[model samples]
Target: MTEPLIERCGLRYLHVVGRNFLVWRKLMYASMLGNMADPMIYLVGLGFGLGGFMPAIEGMRYINFLAGGMLCYSAMNSATFEALYSAFSRLKIQRTWEGIMHAPMTAADVVLGEWIWAALKATLSGAAMLIAMYLLGLVHGLRPLAVMPVVLLIGLAFSGLGLIMTALAKSYEFFIFYFTLVITPMMFLSGVFYPRSALPPVVQAIGAVLPLTHGADLARGLTLGTPMAHPLLDVLVLAGYATCGVSVSVLLIRRRLLK
Candidate 1:
């Protein structure tokens, strides 16, 4: 009974993913263009423009230092955008989730499927950025390839976080508050553009708790071939956020849909 039930759930979610992929295929060009453009601009603009005047950071060129962070940021941005805007549109505007619920699937399955879809999209975006970095010679050696799993982990963490916001959102406008208050701060404070050590002690402490910080640390360590201060702790932190966020998202969306 239990095994069959699990298989059924997996198949249902895979169906959802397949449906989304088909829809995305129609707009693949635009989606890929936008995803590639944004990160490339950031990499060139901040990395070269700003990094030109900056001294070597952590014993590496500024662009080299920024590359790994960009990889993590790409994953984070992709996951969050898919979870917030795309998920909200499906759940509220397009009524896609409503249509899916009419099938044999539960609200839990819908949310899980959406989360998985978002994570996959994030991974693709991150992979694109990683390839660009590699072509530019910012990443070297086989160790950089190890960052792929970390990118997926970052995706999972942010996707779940995005869905939580989606559940609380009453309208599209609600996301402005989340983006401004939460995501923006995390981008700046989470060691993406600079080292966490440069921040004040209190802010550093706060950054330490953010999922992106751990993700950045992991990505940087792998890409630069530097040893992590505490790699095990970083993995644990990201995994904790992903697990909690998904659980909370399921519970929240269940209440919202059932009510």
Candidate 2:
């Protein structure tokens, strides 16, 4: 009985691990090299290059201020790439989940495992960026180090959201709608390049609703030695986003598959 229960619990998640490893295996050194390059370019080009004209922000050098925001941005990008692009393709084209479900695995188990896997990858990417930030001396002392785990939580929050979007997506084209209307606006308005306080009251209120805004706020506060507007509130909001998104994805995938 113990062995059976253990297998039942472990089989689905193990498959998810194996599948993700397989996917990672197909990514060549060139692809990894490109991902490594994109962030550095953003850091140098926008941070160092454009930062000169951008003015000093919040008592820190503009480039340094932007690095925290860029870290948040990078984490979001890594999560969405796996959850939206790859997850949707696997579900629609590869039918990978279908094959897994035919065995002892349930949809819930597979999705939970897959989302965790995506979050793991996102966290790894974020950690890599954090190391780069440390090397630059942008992160001082143990506070930023303490915040590293929270930064990963932020990544998981976005990964969960991206998974839900993948479930809702009717086609890959639908992703553009989200990217354009929601993400693009948030990317610009979120205190990435500038403080949200500079926005009009109404726009500030709107920015408050976006996940990236809170993530960036928390990150910038920690990294730049700025006081948090409301640290607990930001954590709660991020947690809420993760919970709702994961719940929705689980429900949708269950309806589509196990039902």
Candidate 3:
């Protein structure tokens, strides 16, 4: 029988994480190169090309404003890509999860490991954007250091949500609907390219409930050295998403991978 829920995600999950890391290390350079490309383009292309036309937002340059949202966006995309594509390969295409299962572990162990690994890897994406912002002179002082924790939290939030999607996907093509329907809309609504304040009231209401909204607000606040309206509440919302997403995904994946 499978272990109890709490017992399932024990310290042994780290073993799965270590195994994935070894596999990933071989492709680390190529992986980082690919991951850095899009965000860098957005940072430079949009930040300068478009930002020049936009006026100061809430007293900060448009580029500075966009950088914060980009940080959260980068983290979110990184975690989602890892959790969905990489985890699915291990789950279905390669049968890596099966091998790990025979390593004397529960499905929850594998799920949690992937969850944490996605989050960990996502921080690299977030860090890349942050460093770019620094080099471009968009961030200043010690404030950017505060953005790392927010990046990790964004990673955890998206990773959990992505795993939930992965658990239910029947084929690789199934992921297209999610990216197009969910991530794309979220990117627009969560204020990545512009402030949500400029959106219609109805759209604003919907965006407020998304995890990226809170994450963007937190990251933006930290990057710009501004006060977060409700730091505790925003964090609680993100943590809630991560908690529920992982819990539900564990249940779903366990049922999906029958022994």
Q: Is candidate 1 or candidate 3 better by TM-score?
A: 3
State the local distance difference test value for candidate 3.
Answer: 0.90
Candidate 3 is scored at a TM of 0.97
TM-score of 2: 0.89
How high is the CA lDDT of each candidate model?
0.90, 0.78, 0.90
Candidate 3 residues 71-155, lDDT tens each? 8888999999999999999999999998888877888888999999999999999999888988999888886789798788889
Residue pairs with backbone atoms closer than 3 Å in model 2 (clashes): none
What ranges in model 2 sit over 4 Å off? 1-11, 26-28
| Tens-digit lDDT string for candidate 1 (105-137) | 888888888898999999999889988988898
User: For model 2, what is the alpha-carbon lDDT of residue 251?
Assistant: 82
Worst 10 residues of 1 by lDDT: 1-10
Best by TM-score: 3
Q: Where does candidate 3 stray beyond 4 Å?
A: 1-3
Residues 119-231, candidate 2, lDDT per residue (tens digit)?
Answer: 77666666766777888888867778656766677777887888888888888998998789877798888888778889999999999888888888888888778888888
